[model samples]
Target: MPHDDDHVPRRRARSVFVDITPLRESPAFAKLWTGTAVAQIGAQVTIVAVGLHVYALTESTLAVSFVALWALGPMILAGFVGGALADTYDRRRVALVTAIVAWVSISVMATIAFLDVSVTWPYYALAAVNAAAATILGATRGAILPRLLSPQLLPAAAALSGITMGLAITVGPAVAGVLVASVGFPWTYLLDAVLFTGAFLGILSLPTLTPDGPRRALGLDSVLESLRFLRHAPNVRATFVWDLIAMILGSPRVVFPAAGALVLGGGPITVGILTAAFAVGALLSGLFSGPLGAVRLQGRAVTLAVAAFGACTALFGVVLLGTGLIVGPGAPGEPVVPAIVLACIALAGTGAADNVSAVFRTTILQTAAPDDVRGRMQGLFYVVVAGGPRIGDLVAGGLATLIALWAPPLIGGILILGIMLVLVRTARGFMRYDAHAPTP
Candidate 1:
């Protein structure tokens, strides 16, 4: 209930996702959105695949997180390249190229999963490659939107993206877990390969979108220029930092896999259910999110949504605490829980809350940032939005390895709550982000 959105007048805004808003009414935008939805769903499949594979191999949560740990470097590289490409070349082409790369990476992963490859290092390598390519596609996709949709409908478009996120996270992961459990990791991953085609078609079919920035010929200099622009661009800088702090401290995804095996007892099924639960919350939020489409103060929206997210994490930690109390703390190899079914419900609540925060943060970046710098801005955005959660993964993995599995969330939940409060109080511009007069 605690939220920064309380300040936005509770005006009843019309719901638009049931039918295409004027923004996506354009055939190009519809195609682009369809492609993004396909890509998101594939990404979800791979995400669950990686988690299950790691656990299946090592039976260690820490080992699973190494997938995220390895991703840090490639993610950094891909972000820069992808963001720069978004500014320089045709954005659709950039997306296409990355999509191809990601597709190949996932294909390799599928092959390995089918083989039951005992070699863990190769799995990590392939995963990092997949993540890096995904980074490029993700950043450019965001940058491409302004060209696809008119400004008037940007907010609605963003909410629609939230619905996509909801579907990808909720539907994809749930289906993935079932598929992996019923068939195997290879089959789950193969389905992802088939879906990847949708993203390729989506990006390729879109109307040609020319570069808006002064044609700075592509190279190292162009990439460096983006870094420099980021430094000078105060709002852009603030936005990324805000995202970093919010995600690094707040994201609890790292713990979900471990929670499934250790506390919940259902293993991969629990992991998938927990992930889907988060998406459910997000998709449901879109129902009341019509007003968010008309929101003028996005900075406040980010703050409130993030705070709510932190509270949910804390609540998730409480769920862990409850399990520990009921099961009596790792009395053996795995802690026992009375009713894991209810725990999945708690995790789903956490998922929904987090998605609400994502809608606002994404809107801030898409609407506030200029086209010239939007790609790099999105690249940096990925570093945090995509990157911070990985750091949390490492933190969770390492801490879980050293201590009890429950240790990370109890600690992380508190850290998220504290840091978000401090940052919101300090950063007034973000706190005062009026959508009518965007600063970035």
Candidate 2:
């Protein structure tokens, strides 16, 4: 009896960690996850390196910013088209081709840097191409995920993806900073090309995954069909709307730099710490997400998680306001340690909350949406993921300039809390969404 009782607690302890059933039971998904994780980290490294390289070449912040701007339009367009293609053809083949395109773009980017090319247009063009390809790859991979894992295991799979993204964002940029300082731009780009090849192996290992539904011809009409389907997918649409609420109103990343400079008083180092704190929170949340798998009311879970995000964002603003009042506007580089600590804690809370929301939001989409339109739905998801923060940045920056450093987040957070409560009340279908019978 004693031994059996001891084993109970042991099992409970083990269950607190992320569930590895998807990895153990699905070899194809395991390979795909591993490959995608490695490739994403490498892609992040190149993204950071490109920004730093452009800054080095032109010594202009605007020039560095334009690299992202150049990619945005192409990424959105390619994502929709890629989704159509994935729904029409074998997803594995589509992913492989897009990976090849991305790899080639990276290779050319490396070659240009190796030859000591002074012009910047090549880098810009290559960055745009790589972004488009990557957007397509992401949409295809998302579509492939449902086909690989059983619906019951999908929440766990989503948690694993969160870990992948956390590592990619945190480790990748840190590695880029090290590589760029030790080697040069050429070697950094070359390393990305090498890391990118991992994606091809994952793609090759998969069996053909053609859509198991009515196939549409790949064209504008196919993309239009996806949009039309969205009109009916209230649950899916609610998921996207909830995501936008968290990202647009609760995202405080844009304020980090200015906060560090004027409010926090730690300068660039403080900015870096604030940035990494969010990723650390996300990583930790994924690590202990095993309990989330048993959750049946995933839609309500998402709503609750995002509500926490809004609260945390508001709390972060309060921290900034408190720190600013204590430090005043004159002391830029001499931030009190406690103020910084408090601010990091709030940002970390926001990250943790947002990550939980994401796992359920993604699971809801994967389990509810039909296979034929899953790719396009995922494409819209990628667009939301990519575009929301940019919009938030603009909103935050504009509000800060017009009001105060702490105004945007404080106001935005209040808006999110109010709006989300309204959404939960009115979105009856979404609020009652059950994982077992996912309907959208």
Top TM-score model = 2
Residue-pair clash count for candidate 1: 7
lDDT of 2: 0.89
Worst 10 residues of 1 by lDDT: 10-19
For residues 157-218, write the lDDT of model 1, one tens digit per residue. Answer: 77778888788877777778789889988888889888888887678877676677578787
lDDT, candidates in the order shown: 0.74, 0.89
Estimate the TM-score for candidate 2. Answer: 0.98
Q: Which stretches of candidate 1 lie over 4 Å from their true place?
A: 1-19, 22-24, 50-66, 107-124, 181-187, 256-271, 331-346, 397-407, 422-424
| Whole-model lDDT, model 1 | 0.74
Q: In candidate 2, how many clashes are counted?
A: 0
Q: Per-residue lDDT for 1-440 in model 2, tens only?
A: 37777799899999999999999989999999999889989999999999999999999989998999999889888878888888999999999999999999999999999999988889999999999999999999999999999999999999999999988988998999999999989999999999999888778999999998776788889988999999999899988989988788877788888888788877888998999889888988999999999999888899889888888888888888877787776655577788889888878888888899999999999999999999989999988888888888888888888988888788888888788788778877888999999998
Alpha carbon lDDT at 366, candidate 1 = 80
